[model samples]
Target: MTQPSPNTNQLFKILATGQFGTFLTEDGDNKYVLSMSDGGYEAFTPEELERVCPYTIQIDFMAGGGAHFKVPKDHGLEEGDSVIIGRNFGIVKKLDTRRDNAQTAENLRLIVTQPISTQSPQVVA
Candidate 1:
């Protein structure tokens, strides 16, 4: 399989609100909730949501056979929106069971890249 572009694997921070209690990872299952400070519940546009965080985006995939997407941690999450990791594979926002069944199915695959040093070790004099 061809490798994904470097930009494709970059991690993007977004803003979103959590509608219900959701987990980040399957193994750890880190529970994250939305901010109640902005009233009981409110609907925000993708751009507005991004302002809340900075990495939020309107994704199109699936979560547990249901449509899914990724937004910033701060973005207001709702029932329709699924909280997923950057590496959660599968149909991001579609009804594909075959793709959904695949474990570790990352929707918004976020990758962190760093520059490598090219300097070589100098001989002791």
Candidate 2:
């Protein structure tokens, strides 16, 4: 099946800090896929690796249970890429979908490419 690309500019407020392997984000206009890989961390150069700070983030859902995404440090988020309210609000640039054989259903999750936190807003303006 074909998947619709996520609007990279879409804004989502994080309801919880992704400190553990789990967190939460406000719903969006589209459904996203959860990534199963290390978001290309294994491909980083030594210099890049030295600057890396990896963390796993999984969006919390009412149904419960989801994949964990190991986001590489500085996952390319830049100015206007995110904001800071009580929690961090970020733009989701990538998304994916999952199909389970047992359930015969497809699930969507956002590929969290950056760390979510209560840190100062990364917005440039």
Candidate 3:
């Protein structure tokens, strides 16, 4: 097995931020959803981190499964905006909703990427 590149790991960062979230949209081609929390990003306990930034993104699979990233409320991101994660880059968009109140029924922003390679998962030891 080989080590995962920093760029390849970037997508995991976005997915790991969710305290709790459900797939707003999922298909054979792609998946889009919001990951946020009133408690905070990755903050398991209330006072775990002094600076908690709850964020969200919309990813596809082009740059490793992400095309557009969307965030409810102005979490310092807007539509048509682009961001850099590690060595990879992605675009951003703002949803006309609040993070706490965001839902599939409401319009959501999403980061689109490309179809992930249909390869078997690899494990490194």
Per-residue lDDT of candidate 2, residues 1-125 (tens digit) = 54343333322222232211111221353333222133311111112211112343333333334343444434453322332222333343232222111221123223345667988878886
lDDT of 2 at 103: 22
lDDT (10s digit) by residue, model 3, range 1-125: 53222221122223334344322322333333223334322312222212222344453233765533334444555556555654555555343422332222234333445678899999999
Give the TM-scores of the predictions, in the order they appear: 0.20, 0.17, 0.25
Better of 1 and 3 by TM-score: 3
Model 1, runs deviating above 4 Å: 1-55, 58-68, 75-109
What's the alpha carbon RMSD for model 2? Answer: 21.7
Please report, as a residue range, the 10-residue window in candidate 1 with the lowest summed lDDT: 21-30
lDDT of 3 at 26: 29
Mark the 10 consecutive residues where model 3 has the least summed lDDT.
4-13
Residue 31 CA error for candidate 3 (Å)? 28
